[model samples]
Target chain A: PSETHRNAAEARQNTLTKPPGSLGALERIAIQLAALQETERPCADNVQIVLFAGDHGVTAQGISAFPSAVTVEMLRNFASGGAAISVLARKLDARLEVVDAGTLATSEVAGVVTDKPCHGTRDFATTPAMTPDETAFAFDTGRRAVARTVDRGAHLLIFGEMGIGNTTSAAAVAAALLGKAANDLVGAGTGLDSDGIRHKARVIDAALDLHGLKAPDVPAADVLMKVGGLEIAALAGAIVAAAQSRIPVLVDGFIVTAAALAATRLNPSCADWLIYSHRSSEQGHRLILEALDAEPLLDLKMRLGEGSGAAVALSVVRLACALHGEMATFAEAHVSESL
Target chain B: PSETHRNAAEARQNTLTKPPGSLGALERIAIQLAALQETERPCADNVQIVLFAGDHGVTAQGISAFPSAVTVEMLRNFASGGAAISVLARKLDARLEVVDAGTLATSEVAGVVTDKPCHGTRDFATTPAMTPDETAFAFDTGRRAVARTVDRGAHLLIFGEMGIGNTTSAAAVAAALLGKAANDLVGAGTGLDSDGIRHKARVIDAALDLHGLKAPDVPAADVLMKVGGLEIAALAGAIVAAAQSRIPVLVDGFIVTAAALAATRLNPSCADWLIYSHRSSEQGHRLILEALDAEPLLDLKMRLGEGSGAAVALSVVRLACALHGEMATFAEAHVSESL
Candidate 1:
């Protein structure tokens, strides 16, 4: 982000017809976009949603309400344009790309980029989800995916994930990073009842103990290799790459936010390029948001992942850009200003 | 709201590809729209934003950061498509109507409906802001405005207010109705510093004491006559009329919520027709939302109250309806459901 463009945008905002700072976060968003794009007229014209689909080995611990097969089923749904992200991507006129980081089902699906680090991941309850080399491979996969999108003239990047039991993986990563207990970080993924939530929490607790990562000092890559799903590690890499490339990344719900946390942990400066779309209804999302000091654009109590929250928020970001670019100044409108 | 249509919409939502209740408030909003429209295919195709512009005599109390003249200035801004709501209304293709219910500046302006009970209300510190007849007149003005929109085939009604120091009036009305202290409800209106907030709170406290109506049991009409601006009174009337006519009202930020509260107080069932657009950044809005049990669609820390929040949220509401009316069902898409 350029300070010159930010200062210029701030000046432009003050001259627009309304009380100074009356638009609130919309004004801030516009200014931030101006700084990121290094242009006075910042627009979110070219938006793309990259969905990283993988499967969590921790599903073997029975932490999720749905079976692991749902992950593969959803990837197929995404390819068929029947998933939530697909619906939203079409609504926003955004390009949708599904990257198969590593799903349990290894069959090639049309419209899905099949690139696997391994056949899913090892169950983190008894072993690391991925080896160090596999974690690096996934990171490079995500970076390459982002590079492809940016190379295709995509200015706004939205990251979503589809993986059964990935929320448990996210909870483990967050617990390790934030130094919080599993009970505090665990939530019912895909509609768990109270008993199910309790059982899920116990499973995460066991994973945390097994990994011996009940501390905040764990390195980002170490966290991913030990407990993160292949898709999450890829998402973190994409976030870092997007920031490096100066393209704004709109982050989605809880699982995606955990990836953002990992990216920020790896490259603390990457947080500047990330815009949190919405605070998910997921229990641990607020803690992650607070840890990042991220004030999301919306809070619709939406817990569905797959970058749906980010896709929904694309309208607001677009509107912020539209208003910033289209609204007339006080002088042009011939409106009186406060004395 | 038609129960049959609502039931049909709920049934349709249950059959969508996602999990039952996974869409959260979006699903509820769709069902509510279906009920209001009396059709399973709910649509926000024809939307209207009627901005009630007036001047508050309470500006004499130094309660707002900008002068009362800003009320009329903003009306011009709205007319010229320079206001936030104007840009948003244009973006959403919603009709924008500026109703000059009562402004201190009474000159006829292009694109403004110059209907005024008077130039402005009297200073509430020394006297009632409006007489019972004036309050009744304002209500009728609002009801008539809404009637015009509904007659023009507007399916969604969004009410916004443009009045300097209107927040002070709203806070007083909310404080009186909610039985809360002035300090608790008052916030920095239009960039008021801390000292300005304290002064505004003191003014509201004095106004409450002068009216001899500190009790929450005071009549809704009496509260309006005591502290409400002409636009606020008109907004309450508009809400009542919209509800009676079965048109869904997308309630805006703080001042608009206060009007909705007043309408509900007048006719408790009117709350059923209201859809909260966003939780305002204002201090009193949360209390009002709680009192009404309103779950707003968005929370973007927006404090601009020109139907901007409602216009921004119009996209979300439209998307909700679109998803409900357009998304393929589980059977139609051949997607599997959870066990």
Candidate 2:
């Protein structure tokens, strides 16, 4: 981030025709964007939404409420512009691309980029979710996806994911990073009842116990390979790559945030470029967000994935940029400043 | 609100390709808009922003952080497209009309609608803010403003206020209606120190005690006449008038919420037409929002009262409407629903 541009933007915000700090988070967002983009007048106008889709082998442990096939089917929905992210991408005027990281589908879906290293990861309840090579391959796919957006002059990026049983993967990843029990991090994902939640928690606990990465000395990368899904790793890769390119990333709900936690662990410098979008209805998201010391932009209690939360918050960010760049100064308006 | 439309919209939201209630407040917002618009597809496009600018007699008590001259100057700022609300209206593509509700200006500013019932209200510390007749006239001026918007085919209404020391008026009005002490509802207006806040609270308490409206069953109208500013009463009138005309109102921060509380007391039916846009950084805003049973859309801690909060939130509401009306349903997408 450019400190000079950030300081300049902060000064500009104070000069606008409103009370100091009255616009609250909006003012901070503009200054931060200016710093990240290295421009006095920052904007999120040309955002790129890259959605990573995969299938989680953990579904075999009855961890998810939905069937695994739904993951492959939703990719078709995204391609057809019938999915939430599809509609949001169109509405937000964002460039969206789908990446098939490790879904079970044999053939490629139309409009989805095929970079599958495997059909899916192994069930983490009994074994590591992905081999080291597959983990590296999925991460590179995400990095390449963001590089493509930079080629098109994208200003901001939002990473979305479509994977069944991914919430279990997210829970296990968070538990490992935070040094907590599975019960503390597990919550209903896509409508699980109390019994289902308990069962899911037990599955996560067993998986963590099975993997030696649960220890404090374990590298964050090992945790991702052992427990995280392909899309989650891809999201982590995208976040780091966006930071490297100086394009700000808006992190979505529980699943994407878990990837963000991993990204921050892998590359702590990337933390400055990540903007949290919302607190989801999922109970574990708050813990992950607090761990990152992030105060999210919105909290409409939304828990749907596919980057919907971040896509919705893009409007607020764009508005902040507009206000920062367009509003007249107090001197120009001939209005008195605060006494 | 039309219950039939609301129910149908609720059903439609559930049928979308997401888990039931996974969209959370966005879904509720869309459903509420449908009910308020009395249609299956609700859009907040064609919104009318009526910014009421006035000077408060309470400024005589030195209760504000800014000078009273700002009230009139901001009207010019609004007209010349220099103020916060001016930029917001242009960005949202909403119609903006400024009302000289009761500013101290001798003549009208160019392009501002003149409805000055008086030069300004009297200092309520020693006397009632307005005579009964002036209060009625200011309210009618607000009613007329909404009527004009209806003629132009507005689908939603946003009320913003510009008044120096109006926070004192708003705090006093809220204390009267909610039957609370002044300190419980007083905060920094623009940028007051702790000492200034204490001084403001003392003034409000003394004024409320002198007026005898700090008890339950005291008419809400009497509270407005005694302590409310011209812009506050006008906002209340506009809210009720908008409900009568069947256009939904997106209410701004503290000052406007106090007006909404008064409007609800005067006509409980108007509450259904109101959609809260945000919670403000002002300390007392939460109490008033709770009294109104309102859960606002965005809470960026914004306290700028030029309908700016509502204007910023307009993009979120518009996005919600678009997602609701345009997204393909589960049946249309051929995707499996949650088991």
Candidate 3:
């Protein structure tokens, strides 16, 4: 980010027709984008949404509400333009890329990129989710996804995921990286009752104990091998790669945020490029957000994931840039200044 | 609002591919719009923003940070597409109508409706803000403005205000209607120092006492005649007219919300059509919002009026409608539902 450009943007915001600080967060967002984009006029006119899908082996323990096969079905929905992200991508006019990171499907779904790292993970309840090679392959998958968006001239990027029991996987990864107890970080994956949630917590705790990762400063790759879903690792890799390429990443709700947590741990310098989009109603998102020191732009209580929260917030970011770049200055408007 | 349509919308929401209640406020907003529009699908595609500009005699008491001349200058700015509302209206593709509700300017400006109600209100600090006839005329202006938008097939309405010292007028009116102390309602309008705010509060308290209107259930027209700016009264009138015409009103910051409070008092039915858009940074707006039982959609700490907050939030409403109407249902997508 360019400090000189940021200072210049801040100076320009003060000259807009409104009062000094009346625009509040909108002005702050514009200045930050100006610095990150290194331009007098920042733009979010071109956005790319990358969605990675996989089946979670932990669903064998009944941690999620839906069948694991729904992961592959949602990939079909994404291709047929029926899923939430599909509708949002059209509304935002953003590029939508659906990747089958590691699903159990025998054949490819049309319009979805089929580059599987592994069919699925081993149930973390008794074994590591993936081998070290599979984890590395997932990371490469995510980096390649970022390269695709950047080469297509995407001004902004949003990472989404689809897996039936992925939230349990995300909670376990976050618990290990943040050094928090599994019970404190577990939540309803889709629509779990109190009993289901408690059971999920126990499974996570036992897995962390078996993996010996219930401590701070755990290696991100090691944690991914032990508990992270393939799509989750890919999401984290895409975040880090987008940051390295200077395309701002709008981090989504619970599942995506857990990926953001691991991404920050892997490459701390990329932290500046991630803009938290919304706080979810999920149980463990608040602690993870606090761990990342992130303040998301919206809190509509949305927890649908599939990048819906970030997609909803992208409109606000676009408006902020529009107001910053288009509104006339006080001198141009010839309006009297404050007394 | 049609209960049949609302129930149908709710039923449709449950059948969507995501988990129940995961979409949160977006789902609620869509259902409400469906009920209001009396259709299975709702929209906010055609929007009209009515910007009311006027002058306040209370500037004589040093209650505001900007010169009263700014009221007229901003009218020119709005006409020339230099004001915040002007930029936002273009971005939202909404119609922008600049109404010179009442100002001290003697001549008409191009592209502004110079329908002077009373050539601005008298100084409310030591005198009644307007005669009863002038208040009535302002309300008629607001009604006619709404009629024009309704004729233009507008699905939504937004009311904004530009008056240098109108916040003082708004605080005084809100204090009268809500039976609150003037000192509690007064805020730093435009940008005031500590000493200036204290003095403004004192003046408001004195004026409320002199009029014997520091009590609940004060007639809204009487309050307008005693302490309201012409633009404030116009905003209230527009709210009532929009509701009567079956057009949803998206209320803006402090001054507009104060107008909404008075509008609900005048015609309680209008309260059902008002959608609180964003919480402002102004002090009194929170209390007024609470009084109206409003949970605004956004809280970006924005205090810039001219309907900027509501305009920024318009896209969210549009997206909500699009999601509600376009996304594939579980049966249509052939996706499994939650167990």
Pick by DockQ: which candidate is best?
2
Runs with alpha carbons beyond 4 Å of true place in candidate 3: none
* Candidate 2 Cα outliers beyond 4 Å, as residue runs: none
Two-way TM-score contest, 1 vs 3, winner: 3
Candidate 3, B1-339: lDDT as tens digits: 999999999999898888888888899889988988898889999999999988988889988888988888889999999888898899889999999999887899899987767788899889999998899999888998998888798888999999989989999999999999887788778889889989999999999988878776789999998999899988988999999999998889999999999999999999999888899999999999999999898888898899999998898999889889988999999998887
A99-207, model 3: which lDDT tens digit per residue?
9999888898999998777798889999999998999899888999998877788878999998899999999999999999888888777899999999999999999
TM-score of predicted model 3?
0.98
* lDDT ranking from best candidate downward: 2, 3, 1
Residue-level lDDT of model 2, residues A1-339, one tens digit each, is 999999999999999888889999999899989999999999899989999999999999987788988899899999999888998999889988999999999999999999878998999988999999999998998899988888888888999998989989999999999998899889899889999999999999988888975688567889999999899899999899999988899999999999999999999999999988999989999999999999999999888899999999999999898999998899988888887
Best by lDDT: 2
lDDT of 1 by residue, A5-76 (tens): 999999999998777877878888899889988999798879989999889888887778777887887777
Locate the minimum summed-lDDT window of 10 residues in model 2 chain B. B212-221
Q: DockQ for all models, in order? A: 0.53, 0.83, 0.82
Computed on alpha carbons, the lDDT of every model, listed in order, comes to 0.88, 0.91, 0.90
Error of 3 at B23 (Å): 1.1
Kindly list the per-residue Cα lDDT of model 2 for residues B1-339, writing each as its tens digit. Answer: 999999999999988888888888889999999999999999988889999977888888888889998888888889999888888899888999999999999987999999968999999999999999999999998999998888888889999999989999999999999988899899888889999999999999999988888778789889999999898999999999999998999999999999999999999999999999999989999999998899999889898899999998899998889888988888898888876
